[model samples]
Target: MALLAQQLRTPLSTINALAQGLIRRADRLSTHDVQVKAEKIWRASLRLDELIETILSYTRASAGGIMLNPGEFHLSELIKRVCREQGGQEPDRPFHLDVKDVPETIVGDPILLEQALVIVVSNAMKYSRPDQPIDVTARGEDGMVRITIKDRGIGIPERDLPFVLQPFFRGRNAKKLPGTGLGLSLAWYILKLHGGNLEVESREKRGTKVTLMVPETNTTGLSYSI
Candidate 1:
């Protein structure tokens, strides 16, 4: 699956570029329909690229090796970027972010964090109602950075919550959602590799909250209040 994903990346990139180029040349087109078609192609190509990457990440994780490019980044900025990307994909639903008492800098792989947060936030959006808001909050507590995402839609059953972190296991409430059931599992592994773990609390029909806890740097650790 990794090899297939690698092979598809080049062609998919080319396709995305071509679609964007066509959209840029829309003024030369004879009809509005042509422009719309080009735009749709561009969006679809982007979605396909994301799906391909997700599949590749899952495969690599299964092999017990997930590559990451580690660096120092602001946790709040990272959260905002992930939320923005997710919001773009889910315009129909409202998403909110709250950041408190977080350090401006943290050491970790930005790409990996982005991918992991994307998966979590995306899942929150997917399972929640269109009218309901997905709430994301981050704070520093007891030498750990805690980020929580809550969804006010169908919550995971108590029986299935334990298995939700297992690969390919989707909760009963999430069975109807469109997914390969690998997002949360992958996120859990990624967090674990970064000296963190996922904590989930849910009640059927009320809501679900997923808390991600990561150790803060020495500087940030000193500043921790709650």
Candidate 2:
């Protein structure tokens, strides 16, 4: 929760500063400048919402209260949306998505699936250099859909790889970075709830790749109410 408070501070500050700036300088600013500032504020608000939702979901997941409302949805569209949104937040960075081999549709809870993808992609952006590209690729294999996110950033120490998905467990090299370390843990739980799994591979200072696999059909009947 302390890290959650820390993460919230950034977007909250952006929203407050931009709002106050617009209030004081709207009369002197150009219309285009005002529009740009408003967009930044909107994006910051969205970031704040995502951070809070992630924390709440993590809490619910830890309590075994999360559920899956599985249904059919376009997997490609979902991936595209995550890349687009994440790229928008960090315009300097690039998110390259490749889904030609993936099925057009898959059966699962789209909302939760999207959240998992968002978390992974956001992590890629956070650790990677702004100039580096984040690659997201999706494909179908052996009755499951595989989505992988790759980044050229500060990779995890081999010893830390096993605990990367554990809540509040940040890599020694990543300890100084700004993150709560709950995103991957929450994302892994979401995938498991949908009869899926998460995988990670990394090398210190090289790069990292995380893969998420979910069955093409919701046969597990995993559902809960909270």
Candidate 3:
């Protein structure tokens, strides 16, 4: 509630102030100046939209509303598609999709897993530099499929690591970033629903590595879905 209240205040104040500015400077202001204020108002509205979406996801996760439908699909194709989706969100940024040792197929709730993967990728984009490649690597190990996303971004502080999975628990370095601090929490909930775990390793200013591990579907030695 506090975060929401704060988010409401910051953007609402900006829009109100900007509107007042336009009203006061109606005759004096140039078109370019009005354009700049409009841009800020638009940006704030987008931020509000993001905050509301985060709250909705968090509410759903808390209400135990998420369910999974596991089926077989090509992990490579899904990974590529997810990377493409996130990549499109930031056209100027580059992503490196490295699929090594990954199984050709896996059983999962494609929709939920796609959401989880995109959250991971989007976080990488938000923190890391445009020039720094977001490296996504997948592999199979010990009856589980593991995906690791490495970001050369402003890494999380050691003290913040334990609380990253908690909703609205922003890291020390992440305070400046525009987020509701629910991305990892939502991803964590979705992975748990799919019998998977999300893990992270990082050093302050060094970088962060997030690994999502899900046990391979055990169909009594049946390798392919019928």
Candidate 4:
């Protein structure tokens, strides 16, 4: 975790400096595109802040004392926010959000949900080709809100897929990728705490898809037990 934190800090600091510079010169920018770029920079810096917090939270949870602050929020909005946060740097590989079917709201910890989705989506972008599109879809069914993230990347080997969710475990194909291998594990824990499960489907050389199924409500039609 220390290594991961060190690796992330440098880039985050650079982004922070860049964002500040842009903000200082915001009035001098003449074009709409320049202003948009400045906003993206600032948002990206904020996302890095959230990611850093998430890493700390996961570390604290693994130490066995962290608790969630649950609430109600729109699943679609959460997904969009995570995608926007992570995809800001990649302007070429457009994110295609397909909300063909989904619920307006669900009960869960918004911060935790956002962190999990950020992990999955960040991994998707990291492994996928620059020109390939990343797909995010949400749907409500059988009292659950399911969010799926798919990327056209070098897929995991059949034998290694089962172990991918384990903490600090990296696959043969993932050795070259820059990651701590804690994202999936953290995501799994977050979903489990929300009474949800994570599912994966992939074919070697084709692509990979991860589906996070979170319960919409309890049997008594309440968000939490009394």
Candidate 5:
């Protein structure tokens, strides 16, 4: 709770200060200046929205209110879309995608899958250096598909690796970073909800690799349960 409050305050303060500045300086500020500040405000609001949504997901899932709506969708298109969106935010960093071997279509909730991918990709960007690239690779394995996101960032500590998927669990090295620490936990939950699995392999100072495994068909036999 304290961590959540502290993280939320930073963005809220930015939004509040920028909004006030824009209103107060409307008469004197140049169009370009206004645009820049407005953009900052918009980005800060997005950060706040992500934080809120993550909290709600944690709460909802705990109460067994989360449900999966699986269906067939193009996996390549989804990967490309996520990379495009994330790349725009980190224009200096590159996202190399290799999904040719993955099935063209898979069965799952597209919206939820996208959210999980965003969490992983965004974390890769945030933890790694601006010059380092993010590698996303996917391939078929029997009836399942494996999507891997690898990053050349300060990897997780060996001791912390075991707890990385636990809610609100952050690595000692990542303590200085900006995050609520719920992303991996939520992403893991989403995968498990689809009868899939999330795996992580990392060596401190080397980098980290996250693999998401999902079936090509909705064989989980789960329904709209709350």
Candidate 6:
């Protein structure tokens, strides 16, 4: 978790500047710069929010105190929202969202699901080359909803695949990365709570593909209204 906190270092600096301005001269912030700075503050705060969400996922899962507020929503829309949130983080990069035969609405804890998807998507981006494209796609079949996050980046070794879901366990290839390896673990815990599963496939020199599988809602199996 301390390693994850490192991601917020840059944002925290901007936040400090904003706070100092507001503290010393609230009146002189003016309308234009105030709005711009406010937006900066908002973005920085969101980074903190992501950190809190990721940490709570681990703490909540470990305590067996995980909970959900189930609701109905379009899965593709939720995917789009997660991509959009992350898109801001890497404004220069693009994520190809290929959704097909997706249900219009499904029942589940959207917040938790979104967090899980964000983890998968962010990892796909982080582990891959910035110049490469990350793919996000979804489809419903049989009794399940399957979402795939594919990246054409450095792949995980077969030996490491078995341990990737273990808390704080990063593959040899991932050791150079900054994460403490909590993302996949938290994602697995969330999916397990929802009767879902997270799976991965990769090669050393090739790329990797992660699939998130969950059972379809009783009322909407493989059927989409829009």
Alpha-carbon runs more than 4 Å astray in model 4: 1-54, 218-226
> Who is ahead in lDDT, 3 or 6?
3
| Residues forming the 10-long window of minimal summed lDDT in candidate 5 | 217-226
- What is the C-alpha lDDT profile of model 6 across 1-226, one tens digit per residue? 4666675565688799887887787777788877877888987887677667777667777776667667777888999888888877777777888876777787877887898998998888878877788888899887678999998998899888888888878889878765657888888777766677899899876889999986655322221110
Better model by TM-score: candidate 1 vs candidate 5: 5
Candidate 1, residue 88: the lDDT equals 80
lDDT of residue 134 for candidate 4: 97
Question: Pick by TM-score: which candidate is best?
Answer: 5
Stretches of candidate 5 exceeding 4 Å from the true structure: 219-226
Per-candidate clash tally: 1, 0, 0, 0, 0, 0
Residue 162 in model 6: shift from native, Å? 0.8
Instruction: Please state the error at residue 71 of candidate 1 in Å.
Output: 1.9
User: Clashing residue pairs in candidate 3, if any?
Assistant: none
- Pairs that collide, model 5: none
lDDT of 4: 0.77
Error of 4 at 105 (Å): 1.1
- Candidate 2, residues 1-226: lDDT per residue as tens digits? 6777888998899999999999999889999999999899988888788788978897898787777787899999999988997898778887777899988788889999999998999889889888999999998999999999999999999989989988888999998776788889888888888878899999998899999998998845454322
- Candidate 1, 163: how far from true, in Å? 0.3
Model 2, which residues run further than 4 Å from truth? 32-36, 221-226
> TM-scores, in order shown?
0.76, 0.87, 0.77, 0.76, 0.93, 0.77
Predicted structure 2, TM vs. truth: 0.87
Ten residues in sequence with the least summed lDDT for candidate 1: 217-226
Tens-place lDDT digits, model 3, residues 80-116: 8989877875677878888868888887787777878
- Using TM-score as the yardstick, the better of models 2 and 4 is 2
RMSD of each: 6.8, 2.7, 5.7, 5.5, 2.2, 6.1
Instruction: Report lDDT (Cα) of residue 96, candidate 6.
Output: 88
